[model samples]
Target: MDPSFRVLLVCTGNICRSAFAERLGRAWVDETLGEGASRLQLSSAGTRAVVGSGMHPDTALVLAGYGADSGNFRARQLTADHLADADLVLTMTRAHRRDVLSLAPRGLGRTFTLREAGALLDFVDGGSERGEGDHAARARGLVAALAEARSRRPAAGDDDVPDPINQPLETHSEAGQLIVDALLPLLRRLAGAS
Candidate 1:
């Protein structure tokens, strides 16, 4: 059997975005990679909030809309152990990236934001004109550009998947759609990663 590719999806709370990403990413891996899917480990975590609950209602609804099951998901806190074990860590936002890196084990270099990874995949697939050297260098450039762009943006509200801890059900569903949109391509790339 081939070695499993361990992936960790992260967000501020485990109940929403990260959970959606994890489930979708797993399905993508299964569909695209097939037998290789058994060699892939996909999971989600939160920097804070919803540490022990199932996915938020809205997250479930949006995923259900797309025919993805949310039945096996549960919230978990981000931990150093998760970082240590992951071959790749994909976070939702820049803030979530910082939080995960802060807790990441030393010398661990396989972490990135979902957008950043998407950008790198674009670069690799010839969607962008950038020439690649090392994957690390390419990943860093992608992340830096994303962080710079994020700094100049306005804060995202319910449209941004606001924690959803006390928010309305509609909010969680909105957040789930946002997450699914962001995850689709990244999942495709990871599936193609050999």
Candidate 2:
């Protein structure tokens, strides 16, 4: 059997965007993959974390409104070691992608913004039966497609997840929705959702 895919999410602070992505990504895995969710391990950290902070209070409110929970998350700083560890580094911004690459040059082919991953997944989805056998195989094809996209001229960076720290309730909620819109569908495909 193939090894589990490790997804490490990165943002400016783990308290907001990355933590939120982790939750939403996990929810998609659970909902779409069911017993296969364990095949994809998700975690998050900050490019410049506060180290021990919890999720922004309003983040919980936003997630709760969407029927999910932050579930006792604590922030951690991104490190070179972590960049080396993840099978894929999903960044909240292009800067975070560069940050991961600077720390671990070998990550160049494996890291992408959530939306960037979406774009590449589209390419793979449009033309492929090689990855049709199983949930994990299709997910692997998607990851391979993302790396292929990174190798080309860096694709445009329009899908950045905005930082919502210290923002109004509406802004926080918007951030949540933006992330969900960008992330959920891609995750569903990874978990073999239709």
Best by TM-score: 2
lDDT of the candidates, in the order given: 0.65, 0.78
Per-candidate TM equals 0.72, 0.87
111-188 in candidate 1: lDDT tens per residue?
A: 666655554453343322133643333333443444344444455442223455577877767666666666777555
Q: How well does candidate 1 score on lDDT at residue 52?
A: 74
Separate clash counts for every candidate:
1, 0
Model 2 global lDDT (CA atoms, 0 to 1)? 0.78
Ten residues in a row with the worst lDDT in model 1? 122-131
**TM-score: model 1 vs. ground truth:** 0.72
Against the true structure, candidate 2 reaches a TM-score of 0.87
Q: How far is candidate 1 from the true structure (C-alpha RMSD, Å)?
A: 5.4
